[model samples]
Target: MTQTLEVTQAAEVTQAAEVTQAVERPLQTAKPALGRGLLLLMSVATGLSVAGNYFAQPLLDLMGRELRLSTTMAALIVTAAQVGYALGLMLLVPLGDLVERRRLAVSLFGATAAFLVLTALAPNGSILLLGTALTALTSVAAQVVVPYAVTLAAPEQRGRVVGTVMTGLLLGALLARTASGALSELGGWRTVYWVNAVLMIVVAVLLRRHLPKLHTPAGLRYPALLRSTFALFRTEPLLRWRAGIAALSLASFNVLWTAVTFLLAGTYGWSEGAIGLFGLVGVAGALSTLAAGRLADRGFVQWLTGAGTALLALSWLAVGAGGASMWWLIGGVLVLNVAQSSLLNANQNVIYALRPEIRNRLNSAFMTAFFAGGATGSALTSIVWVSAGWTGVSVLGGSLATGTFVLWVLERVRTHA
Candidate 1:
């Protein structure tokens, strides 16, 4: 009886060891990573963040005229937001890995909400500019949150995941002008900010409870993190040149739209309400971001990016020809926005493929160039418009698009070589 009891105990221990080994083997096996929930959350957050950044675009003319700002000075308000966003990407996004992201996200949302209120209440242009910058800086919530989503996805699925989230981002950027214009018509520009303030707060609350815990590497010193970001620029030649293409393309995009407000209102006598309706049309093109993203996932980054850049050049030419012809202008606007969205998504999707471990830092480097190009575009647009006119603006816009095409060709050659 004693020998039989000992034999049963030994068999039970052996079975338990087999079960443990089975569990460990599956963990080690390669499997497809799925992260749709993380993508959904990122999309929602990104949409909200983009909406906040662009509420001022369509209303710039109205606000500037009402506030007694010079054209260039008024333009600065928009540029300031871009500058602030760039700063946030550089300094704060890297903190995603170093800090508790959920807490940081909530705090930034609250801070941005407060600043929007400040923007609504500001008495003068300078105060309004400062408030706008603060609001944009707060919108970096997307930058932090999106890259975290990329980390959760499988390496193979990163492009699709990033593209899916960016669809929300593109929608937000395109819709913001429409929402702002329609809201401003009903209750003035201040009302637009007021409404978004509440929306952001709600998004913050949802994220706080629902976001999954993410892992960040431990023991990364500040200098090390900074060095990693810098290294991307130095070592990643594709990232470097791709970013330049993105910058040039973005510059032309901003130049056209920033100057269009004045031309549409002053030259064509178009109402803000009418202009806002055009943004709705642009949504058709904006929706293509999903397709662009999926294509990037299929290893067609160079082709998608190259085609998108060519589209940008054509759209600019169309807009230049159609100046003041409402239908022509509207058609060009739709094409331009669509092509730009595709190009932007293509760049982002390709970058996501390169860096999984340092997504935040990589994103910061990419977006910094994106916004910096936007800032440079906005700043130079007024000068070009004043010196030459809508036609001149079109020339510059088209030429920049052409430059992006050259950059794309360079990227492809380098990649194949």
Candidate 2:
């Protein structure tokens, strides 16, 4: 009886050991190293994904004229896009953790393509608004691709990777206005959406073929995952601070972009092509992403944030003078782009470092707040542009930037304290 009991205990222990090893093997294995080709693809795809939302910025006037809508009604298209993007960031981005990223991204791209076509064919303001909102909502695929890129990158190289990918995103955003303007000149505003819908389809196929499959079990159900995302803001001061900074920074950014179209078209009497070409001035700022990322990797994140916020506040001075001189507007746009990009990169680096396992959730929390500010700014800028004109818009943007700087100072003091 004693011998039989001993044999039974030994068998049970051996079986437990086997089960432990099986569970641990996958955890211990390292992911394949990310390649430059794949990285570039992701960067391009991210840019393309986000470009859909901004196509209306430069074309708002043309759209308004053709659709027989008022300026306020046309501006609401921008607001709707931002609001939809914010909601998507809050809702869909968290699914990256729960689902396979490639499928989620590819599905979003396809859906965006479909909606862009809908937007192109819309006969009236109501349909256009619906299509634009749905298109922007699905465009959060860019947000998903961002964290997915971070996951593929090595820990030491994460900052550079983020910068490279973000550069693509920024370019897509700034350049979309240029493309829309040029395309509108060539064909019309509707042509811009048709072309982009095709581009989205092409990119979706490329991503489906090239993006490696990665699935990390989040172990929580949908509702719990969402609850956990919001809970992060309450528990993590870093997340809260970063999220606040993101909101203010984006608010300032949207304030400028939302109103600048009106300024250029009405005051300067610029052609759509010329206004589109103006977006190129901000290309220099987009180029700052790589340097900002490298700097963040080297531990200059806080300094980058401080400089960016200060520069953002000062850029409004140039922008205020833009109503009088094109040169001032150009300089203001350049500085504003650089400042916004640097601030955004630094904030992302900070939050991404906080909880590697829950990056999607962190991103959802941060970007939701970020785009909420953008939506608010776009909405207010339309009202401000009507009520107070260029000076009012500048004050609003500058005040938001200044507020961000103050928050950064407070964060710095708290850290030291």
Candidate 3:
């Protein structure tokens, strides 16, 4: 009897060990904690990627003068980058799963740097357009690095981690306008490209050193991979709804930017240097991005969605009230950016919660739509600015913001039902 009892006890202990080992293995494979310095490095790289994409925005006027292009033609410089970025998201970001992410990031950095140089050297409008397109396409390194950061972070801390990275990204977007404007005024528009070229070269080197080797296990075939991207469109109703809102929200954001520069420069006789200061005030929005992320993590996702949407709506509504005063315009711009960034962070937090394996692909799809809409907004702004001026631009932009709110309601209804 004693011998039988001993054998049974041993068997029970062995079973418990097996169960514990099964649970431990996955935890072991999870990414290690990211140090503060590494997070900061990622932020800087992301910021540069954002800044590079916008180098042509504030300089559109200079390009129009130098290249003998129309307003619509000049606007292409901004849209072309958006188009290229969309293409990269569609074609390149998914490879995060098939290749070593670190190598992929470095290679993208190099390609983007090369394109920046080409942009600096372009002798005519066509060559410049080509270089801008290439630079935008290759700037997918930002997408690569961001998702890589998400993967490396602890799941509980993912929102905060992503928020920090986005703060950097938003700063880049804001400062891009200021820096590009200032540099263009002081040294000519072409100087913007020269500056970007040098910065990208430095970013590539830092990425090579700071980012750890990232391994991605292959899970699907090429055709299957493409199919998976589309599947998100079909299967995830919330993603679809939120992505639509994102497109419209971003459109509103871009419309303001693409037209405001021209309006300030043409009507107000503001120099590039003066116009850049608008971006300084816009930097206040970065705080919203961080706040939204923290809010989402605390299970206040619904509240964030509501508050952000309301703020966006108010931003557009303010334009109607502030048509002539610079103070009002500045206030509206700051509010608009804050609302957009907050909503963006909240939306991304929700999407990231859906699937861990396909986060990269998912980001690509959503960001592609997000940027494509921005291109459309910019294109529309150019045409509208030429014909109707600031009033017309504001009317169009306000309508887009209102549309985003309607979509937000639809999302809320769907979630409840």
Candidate 4:
């Protein structure tokens, strides 16, 4: 009886060792190196996720006419979307550190798809505004995907990876206007949302299948996670400076985008399709993202910021001239797009370097400030457009650009000192 008992005990110990090895195997294996194909998929997903917020830009006029909204209310739709996005940056994005990133991203993408349908089916202006806000709020999945991509890349290549993904994001944002206008022309403004809703679902499925699983539990609970995100602004001066610059750059960007539809549709007498096609002009700016990323990787970030800010200020001059000459406006837009893209890439490169472990939190803080500036610009433009017309809008955009330049100068002085 004693011999039999000893054999059984030995067999049980052997099974336990096998179970331990099974658990340890995955932890010991290295993750596959990030590939160009996977990187492109991420970029495409990022772009499509952000596109929903922008679809309304070109469709504002048609939406207003159909919904019987005043000009101010029509413009507020843009503000609502920006505000919602800001909220998401603060509230939802930080959760990336607390949960499985792939699941967080996929869930947000699916939610955005549902919200797009809600926006498309709105029966009145109020519903439309709500839907737009919800859609924008969830569309921050784009931001989540960005840090996820960064986490997968080697430290040496983080800047280039960010730039590549950002290129897709910028394209989605710029092209949404074009797609909205063309789709609206073919069907109606509602069609733009419906079509995008479908696209969101498709991207969600792709992301679910391909996004490698990564869960780095930030150890902090939900409330602490949020507190730490806010704390980053206080502790990291570089984050503060970059966040401020991000705000002003995006504000200037939105100031043009929000009011330009009014300028083009009313002043130039352009059709929806024509105004949409004009967004293609900014595609040239998106192309600069990859090059800017490469430059940042090489340690030319400060020079990039200075040059970009100066170019931004100069672009407004051309944008102001666009009031009479389309050629001047086109030139201005090209410069503005390049400046904005380059500055954004530089800002992110520095911040991402500061804290690799909490990139999502860093991104949240920076983007919240960024979109808040966008919201402010959209709101200010609506008011300025009413009182001073296109000239007022031009002055607003130029002032914001100048402020950004001045801020960059201050940053240089302070850092060098």
Instruction: Show how many residue pairs clash in every candidate, following the order shown.
Output: 0, 0, 0, 0
Q: Give per-model CA RMSD.
A: 8.2, 4.6, 5.7, 7.6
Q: Candidate 3: worst 10 consecutive residues by lDDT?
A: 22-31
lDDT of each: 0.79, 0.89, 0.80, 0.88
Candidate 4 wrongly placed segments (more than 4 Å): 1-31, 61-76
Best by TM-score: 2
Residue-by-residue lDDT tens digits, candidate 1, 1-417: 999999999999998787555433432331233346656766977887878788887788889877888898788887788878887888778777566666777788888888989999878899999999998887898888777666666655666777788778778887888888888989988999999888888888877767655545424787677777867899888789878998998898988778887777778887877766655776776678777777877888777888899999999877987676777777888888888888988888777667555667788888888878877887788899999999889998999889999998887788789
Per-candidate TM-score against the hidden true structure: 0.84, 0.88, 0.86, 0.87
Better of 2 and 3 by lDDT: 2
Compose the digit string of candidate 2's lDDT tens values, residues 208-244.
9988776665778999999999999899998888889
Clashing residue pairs in candidate 3 (N, C-alpha, C atoms within 3 angstroms): none
Order the candidates by lDDT, highest first: 2, 4, 3, 1
Model 3 lDDT tens row, 8-84: 99999998787566533433454674678888988888888868888887688788898888787787787688778
TM-score of 1: 0.84
Residues 119-184, model 4: lDDT tens digits: 999989999999999998998999998988887877678779989999999999888887887788
Quote model 2's TM-score: 0.88
Question: Which residue pairs overlap in candidate 2's backbone?
Answer: none
